[model samples]
Target: MTLFIGIVIFLVTFVFMEFMAWFSHKYIMHGFLWVLHKDHHHKDHDSWFERNDAFFIIYAVVSMSFIITASNTWFWYGLPIGFGIMAYGAAYFLVHDIFIHQRFKLLRNANNWYARGVRRAHKIHHKHLGKEEGECFGMLFVPFKYFKK
Candidate 1:
């Protein structure tokens, strides 16, 4: 029963993180923190990393808090939740950074329909180099209109 609960917690947390990602990207990142996220849309630095990458630290601290709470407190479900958040982060990095942005030289040839759709949606998001008037969608759950037929 505990294992099943843990798995459920993990899956639920993973799905919830998608909504959180979209919310934060639209409101927080594009809101006051546009100073950081704008560089992602516009190239102002020569380094391999963007100031926008700082956002990950917030999620990292959150995930670590969950793991530490699980270790020292009664909230054992935090373990699964932490892992779920980390897993979603991994997926976002793989799809957004590695596959879509080509931050690394891998996953560049994933020419499937889903991959194309994700890329197209992201392309639309990046079309606006500013904070306002941008459409921020979930990483895994893009609109069907963005997908190809």
Candidate 2:
């Protein structure tokens, strides 16, 4: 029962994570909270926290709560929710820190199709002015033309 529940949670969480990625990037990261995220772009060197990657801390805590209490279906709902949040964090960490920004480029070695797409998309986002940040709102599945304009 526990393992089955975990698998179910994982699939649901992937969807939720994708949606959360869209929402947070579209509204939060590019919106008012860009003040903190801006440090990531402007700083010459990034410390452990200055990278502004700590945003996932909140998601981790919330998802952990659900996983811990997931005996019931109600709690099981949190499995996917938590997984989604973690997925976003992982995607952000891998894509932004590893590929696009090259903050931790040592760990990155290859440039696959998705990686190239995401890097190009994010580059376009960075090149645009503040008002034009809307082009690459979707992180994992964005169309290239969205940023071409």
Task: Point to the candidate with the largest TM-score.
Answer: 1
Q: Please give, for residues 72-128, the per-residue lDDT of candidate 1 as tens digits.
A: 999999999999999999888888889999999998788988998999999999999
Error of 2 at 112 (Å): 3.5
Off by over 4 Å in 2: 1-6, 44-48, 71-74, 129-134, 144-149
lDDT of 1 at 25: 96
Please give, for residues 1-149, the per-residue lDDT of candidate 2 as tens digits. Answer: 87787777687777667677777766877787876566655564636567456566766787677766665656656666666567767876776676666666464666676666676777677775463345545666678554432
Residue 70's lDDT within candidate 2 is: 63
| Candidate 1 residue pairs in clash (backbone atoms < 3 Å) | none
Off by over 4 Å in 1: none
Error of 2 at 61 (Å): 2.1
Candidate lDDT (C-alpha), each: 0.92, 0.66
